[model samples]
Target: MNVLSVALSVLETALVFVVMVSVLVAAHEYGHYIFARLFGMGAEEFCIGVGVRPLLTWGRRRYRLALSESERAALPMAEGALDAGEPPRELNEETRFTVRAWPIGGFVRIKGMVPQEDGSEVRVPGGFYSKAPWKRLVVLFGGPLFSVLAGVLILFFLYWAVGATRPAGTSIEGIVRGGPAQAAGLLPGDRLTAIDGQPVLEFYDVVSRVRDQAGRDLQVRYVRQGVERETRLQPKLAELPDAVMGSDHLPTGEMRRQAKIGAAFGLVHVALGPVGALAEAVSRPQQAVVGMIAIFERKVKVEDSVGGPIALATMTDAAVRQGILTLIEWAGILSISVGIFNLLPVLGVLDGGQMVTALIEMLRGGRRLSYKVQNAMAAVGFSMIVLIVIGVFFVDIKRLVMPSRPMPEFVPIEAPKR
Candidate 1:
């Protein structure tokens, strides 16, 4: 690649990564800040995005909302306040909100999150540890909850923007090799509407009718590209476990004769009402979580499927070529994944682990863990997190240096077209 093109790609990747991270971090930390505020548990500082340390020393790093003329007039007369063209903050006495130059990512400082030098949690009125265990649990769970909700909202917007995938009548996903459906010329994308003129609207309508008609010729009506047509096919005898043909849950090694015209069903995109869109959106995160969990039992290996920074950067660059919507959809998935990752009980390293502790405290009637035990768990969790990061980075670096298949060299704009 030309130096300029390569440079631009790097810049694009960095910008997208920073912006997505900021959005997700803000979504997560905002939950904590809001619940903390709701419970009257003070937050000391809230900062979003990153900036040069030098810029932080400029004209007015601190500011309060200019709500009304009277309030504006009553504003504090700090030295050099509001001197610059912009002061990127809205201030409050209890909690400070500051925007960094980059305007991406977030960091929060809440009262009593950390213990004092004496190794005792601050028990002040608005302090975190001072609250009841149940309140603390809510505060802890709030971050992941909002992250998941944010993902759902993002996905909802996506599904609304571009209709959701759902069953649209009955259509073929696959035809069993040399089977009745194949012999009858039933093809993928052909929407079957009826069997022997009986209306077919649901999945079971086809299944029930086909299974009972072994060796019987049946007329199947289907729509393809707005044209209605008919085909005749006879169900072939197939052996299945007695469970489906009968009522037993166990197979008992007994094969039952079942009428079958083998084909897999297909899905089509359909416009969703608001409620349907929300329901579908909610399901995506659940599916994402289950898919990730399936890694241990059934899913693909991490190196094969999981994407680290390099992979994300690559996708971001590609998505940038496609459009903003692609980026938004990707961000939604990433947000959900990050949220789920945090919910893994990793003690000091993740909110979920701390939540488990809070739950334990609540269950035990507010009895807290000892400093020693807490510290030990924290150390172990931190180590695990470090290992995870290292493993991901290793996989990324390996792919870069020794890709299984040779990657085409990036060509500059000036390069001759093949």
Candidate 2:
């Protein structure tokens, strides 16, 4: 890539990453903000980002009851009091606004977030601790629940925007020499009709069937030269390394040899119906848990497995180079992953924190705990998450810095001279 083009790519990648992270963080904060409002707890501030002042301000808005004439008349005095550099005679309780900041991570600073002594003179009714157990539960759970929801929406947009692969009739586009298909005389231009007796619609479906039926005979039906035929072929059992779609580390020759399974007959549909979306949302968490366990067990290495923003962009760029269908495949994998990770039960950070509080409530007989303790515990959990994010960032850096493997040299088949 030229310098300018490369720069553009980097900018695009950064933009996509920022959008993903900011949106996820905002969704999480919104959960807390919404629930706090619902339960009548006053949230003093809701801001995104950590350290810097916001580059721009979008003032918060709330529905206000119309003021009586006397109250309206008092507004000018209140304004005058502030303009005259004097404290307002009394704080007006009517108008409240949420302030948004430029930084992505945010907080819902609710009243009485910490505990107070029972006999303390400084008790506030709107304190977080004063809220009922159910209300607290909802408030705590909302952030992570919303994170998952945001992830689902992201996945949906990814699918809809990037588009899903339509499954067309399976046709052999290329062959690997000495491989089982090649050994069985499977050649380019042959349309695969069925696997055993089942009709085959897409090449990927065929791949799934073949992988499952390893070492077994494949009673494959194909059409060639305007004639339909059947051939019994066995897929060779060869160990393949774990890799994501459109990875560049794949053997160039191997990649070149593999058939392109593009332009399938049926559309890869994503139903926007509530049932489908909810099903996706519910299933994502389980998938994330399974994936996490697999990674922890070393069944999947972090390098070969996970992709943060950099990796995602690298993959996207590579996929775009490869073709459109591969991009869709990557989108599917990323979507499932985003869903799963948000559902983790790690306390204090987001969903996991909510789960933790719920579990604590269950143990404590439904009594509200000190909000201070809860917030403190959550802070610790959030710290842990920050550490993990740092680790992932390093991992991403390593991948970016590591040089890719050199493409292999291949000998060409000599055609017979006339």
Candidate 3:
């Protein structure tokens, strides 16, 4: 592609990423806002994005009510001021609803949720800190919970509308040129019937048989254009680089050997019923949480597994190219990931950290930590989070700028002369 095309693609990808992140963050913060309001906690500001000044503000009272004639006279009158003897217009109490310039995420600032630097207690009614510990815990938990819930709903809609991809039978989608499968005359759309006299039930079965029989000739039976065919081929031991292996612990120069037939395929899409869709939606979050735990446990390499915003944009671009369904599915996955990340107990500025602090306060019989101590701890936590983000950003930039070596091309076998 030309430079302009590349630039446009990047811009589009970035726009999509920003919009998705904004929506997800808004949903998350809305959860906090809603729950806080439910518990009568005062929310001073609910806004999308983080910056010193907001570009736009809503929910501000448009008119002053119950103004005396003297006070009204002092105020500048509009083009259509109240007529003689007209009572002042009544407006609901204002909450600062804003959209800030930076679009990297958002927050709902609940009053008295955290101590200010001035060390003054919020003794006002409906202050977050003045609430019961359990209520505070619920308020903190709301953000992540809402994120997960949004993911689940997205998954359900995608499944219901576009169906879920699943293995139906053994069918090849594409073959890598010069690979064993291509050498054996396996073509796209061919359905594998059996291997080594063993019937193939699904695509995974064919993969397993090929892997198990690596370096050994295998009698493969397949159907193409309603005709049965057989071919004998040996699977190759392909060297997979770290990018392909997807393991962080693997040294940069290291490569892992894997049995390969050099074929690419996917399962058929099966339309799901409402129940099935709901089940799939529920399972996605569970799977994401489990995968995150695996990453934390070192079962998955951090470099290979964890991704920052740049990585997400790249992935989103690829998904968009695939199709709308795929993009929606990716969005759901990302939402779940964000939810789980926020619930990790390490960062004091995050929901999990707030919960931990609240729990400690509860254990201490309602005695709260001093503002100075809390602020110091929060600063430390925020610094840690920033450092981690910077590290991940660098990693993402490196990965993007230094492209990994491409997979070895398959060389198609030459046809014998007649």
Candidate 4:
């Protein structure tokens, strides 16, 4: 490929990675928002990104009627104020959505989720801690749950619209323009059954038959939409890239003359019924869990198996080159991974650790940790997250610099004097 093509490919890879990450993150945040709303632990703000200042801000800042008269006076009031011992003039809005100045990242601020929650929570009636411990557990679980569900839905769609690949005895995936296949009235989705009156079971059968019969008109029999048909085609002799020496290395700059219909043979999509699709889709989460276990058990080397954003871009680029179905499969797997990662129990900032706290509070008969302790955990958790990100980036860079499978060094050989 030329330099321009390489640049374009890299651009496309970055775009796909950004889009995939954005969608999954949105799903996760929306999950938390919805569950908080459901349990009356109303959120204070929902912003696409945390920024220095908001680009556009709307919605009223409703004053909590439960706050003391003096506290109400000190608070900045929007809309209007209420008289002493009088009710609020307008209904309170639980949350206000904002578009921030930053173009990337997102955050949802749940009410009374701060370190000073105890002191400030009096301003709001249904603070997060005010809810039952079980309710808190459910709220914490919501984000990961949504991410996994998104993966399941993607898998289901793929199964319903594009079934798994069938390599052997596959149908014609595409017809080459202005080539023999097009000239002979051959179209995509046609299943090759025979060539020149000889039974053709695999791709090799067609290759073997046509490779030696160039320039000779041969009977090509195929099944199209359940109807058997026949056509004749004269295979053209074309010089194509044919690589050999395939033991961990392939020789470059090699070409061979072979017969060609000028078409690509690939997997055929056989869509499944709704029931079957749904069944296959839901199984993905379990498979993902098993894989995670394998990684943790040291059966899979961390360096070989795990990577950060850079590695993600590289993998995404490779998947894009593979085919549409392969890319879709990668997406489904990635969505599931996002859900799984959030549920890691090691970090206080993650959903799993928060759920553990909720469970512990419930077991301790409603007693909760002090704000100071919670703040410490939050600080440590955030610091740990930052360190982890840095570590993963370093690993990705190292892997890129020193690839596990080194590229073969080729010694160019001048063409022998003919």
Candidate 5:
């Protein structure tokens, strides 16, 4: 692609990434808003994207049709008053809505999310921290739950559309030299009808049966050229050097274990389509969460797993080139990542911080911390998060500017003219 085209592609990829992140964020905030509404607490404002004022409204009515001369003139003065802690004749509708200059993410605002110290009280009813602990947990849990649900839905659709792999025909697509299947005289296109006298419908069934066998014998049924045959295949439990978890991969041990099946795709397994899809969807989020936890625990190094905007855009671009189904899988994985990360209960910058605080409260017996304290902590957390984001942005930019080295050149000899 040309420079402009490449830039556009990158921009589009970034936008998709932002949207995925923002949607998950919106779901999390919506959780808080819904619960706030349910608890009879006031929810002052909700919005989908960040930066710049798109339109202004109060309740369900559009208050400011456009940024008029009158409205513009009133903006500075109104903002000044609001900043000064002077309440407007009524809560300014404009204050309740905003469109920021940057549209990277979205947020929700509750009137009294922070607790006040010095016995000072919140006059506004809908602050987040003011709600019951259970309510707080619901709000806190919402983001991850939304993300998981989103994954499930995506998986369901993907599965329903594509179906899952099963072991009906035992055919070795390619066997490693000296590997178990190869040693058993198994050849490509061999139909595996059974394992250990048990009829197997899916490739996964054979894999599952074989995995626990470490050193046990596998009785396989095969049909080759219209001939039925059985063979005793001893599965050699080889200590393969990390065949999975690539340098850029950060899957947990659990994830690795679940995906370690080697079975041939066949017709009988394909018949159980819905079941396969459902299983795929449900397992996705769990995989993501475990991956994240593994990364966090230093079991997986950040350098081995981390990717900034550039890396992600590059991956997305690659996916786009590969085809739609591949792209959907990548999108699903990224969505799950965004969802899982945002639920990390650290109370400040991301939605998870408040959740962590709420969880802490749940574990410890005490009146909730003052809103002021919570807010201050949140602010600190938010500031730190902003710094990290800035750092990532620079890292991404650095990769763009610092061109990669050209591959080493090798000279080739010219053959004699014939």
Candidate 6:
């Protein structure tokens, strides 16, 4: 593609990525808003982006509706004066709904979440801090819970519309040129029936056997054009790219060595009924959560396994090229991943961190932690999150700018003439 075309494509992809992210964020924040409202913790403001000024607004304290700059400034100023103990101009009952210029993420502001150090308290009814710990816990859990539910719903719709994709058998779909499989004369239509005389039930069985015998010759038996054929090939040690590992961490600069035959194959899609679709949808998120836990436990390397926003956008672009079904499935996966990550009980400004603070207060028999200590914890958490985002961006840039080395080829041994 030309420079202009490439630029446009990148911009388009970025816009789509931003829209998808905004939807996910909105879903999460809406969960908190709904639950807060349900429990009488009134939301002061519900916004779908972050900025000093909103581009559009609804509900109470509305602005930018063909109003002049001075007029717009007067609204917030009046509210500020009222907040400063001045006489109320009018009692505003509606919660502000805003759409900011920056469409990155969103937030829902609950009333009286913070404690006043001067021994003063918010006299407003249904303040967040006025609720019991259990109520607060439910509110805190709502965001992640909604994210997970969104993922499941996406999957259900995808399965109902398209189908549930799963492994069918051990048929080879494609082979990497100059790789072991191609060199071994394994054609695309070939089906692996056995390996070293061991029956191959599925594609994974063949992969498992090959992974265990790197650099060693192995007998492969397959059906080609309805004829049983035998040949010998060795799995080569390849320095695979860290992106393949699908972790969230940055690349370690050290390549991961893995055994590979350089062939790609996967399951076929089967149309599902409503019940089957629901089951598949539920199971998929559970598997994603388990996989994420594996990544966190260091059982998997982040660079090789995890992907950040760039990777996700790239994947989404690829899915768009493939079809809408693939894109929907990817969206579901992304939602589930975000949901699980947000629920990690770490010392940060995340939902889990807030939940942890509430839990501590509960354990202390309703005694709250000092604001100073909470602020320190929040600061540390924010710093850690910032560092992680930087690392992910670095890895993403490196992957885009510097491609990995080409895969090494292997020469196959000729089969004896029949």
Residue 199 lDDT in candidate 6: 90
Superposed model 2: Cα runs more than 4 Å off: 52-56, 62-104, 114-123, 151-163, 176-179, 196-208, 217-219, 228-232, 236-299, 312-340, 367-383, 403-418
Candidate 1 lDDT over 1-418, as tens digits, reads: 8999989888987888887877888898888878877765667777776665323422222323223333234334444566763333334435666667665456566667875545446344356776788998898888888888999899898878786655444776667767788788777667889999898886657766777689899999988777888999999876421223212111222223568776777667777778767776776576666556655444345675566777777777787778887888778887888778778898876889989888988898987777777888889999988988898888888888878544322222232112
Residue 13 in candidate 4, Cα distance off native in Å: 2.4
TM-score for each prediction?
0.64, 0.64, 0.74, 0.63, 0.63, 0.76
Worst ten in a row by lDDT for model 1: 241-250
Output the number of the lDDT-best candidate: 3
**Residue by residue across 1-418, what tens digits does model 3's lDDT show?**
9999999988888888788888988889988988987876667788898899888996652222233343344334443554544433321234588999888889988766667665444343456776777788899999999999999999998888877877557777767877898788777777889989999877667656765466999898988778888888889876532112112111122223457787776667788888878877887676666566656666555666677877887899998788878888888888888888889775478898888888888898877788777877788889979987988898798788887557656444343222
How do the residues 325-373 of candidate 6 rate in per-residue lDDT, one tens digit apiece? 7777888878887888888776647888889988987898866678678
Which one wins by lDDT: 2 or 4? 4
Per-residue C-alpha lDDT of model 5 across residues 11-41, encoded as one tens digit per residue: 8777766665556556656665666555545
| Local error of candidate 5 at residue 1 (angstroms) | 5.3
State the TM-score for model 1. Answer: 0.64
RMSD of 4: 13.5
Q: Which scores higher on TM-score, 3 or 6?
A: 6
Between 2 and 5, whose lDDT is larger? 5
Better of 2 and 3 by TM-score: 3
Q: Please identify model 4 stretches exceeding 4 Å from their true place.
A: 49-91, 98-105, 117-119, 166-270, 405-418
| Candidate 2 C-alpha lDDT tens digits along 1-418 | 7999988877765665455556566777788888877776667667666654445445655432233333334334555666675433333222133334443456777766644545221134444655556677778778766766666665555544543333444776556555666666666667888878988766555755565465677788888767888877776543323322222111111111122221122334533445444444344455555557657766656665676666766776776567655654444455445445655665666555666676687578766556677667778888878877888788899877885443322223333122
Which of 2 and 6 is the better model by TM-score?
6
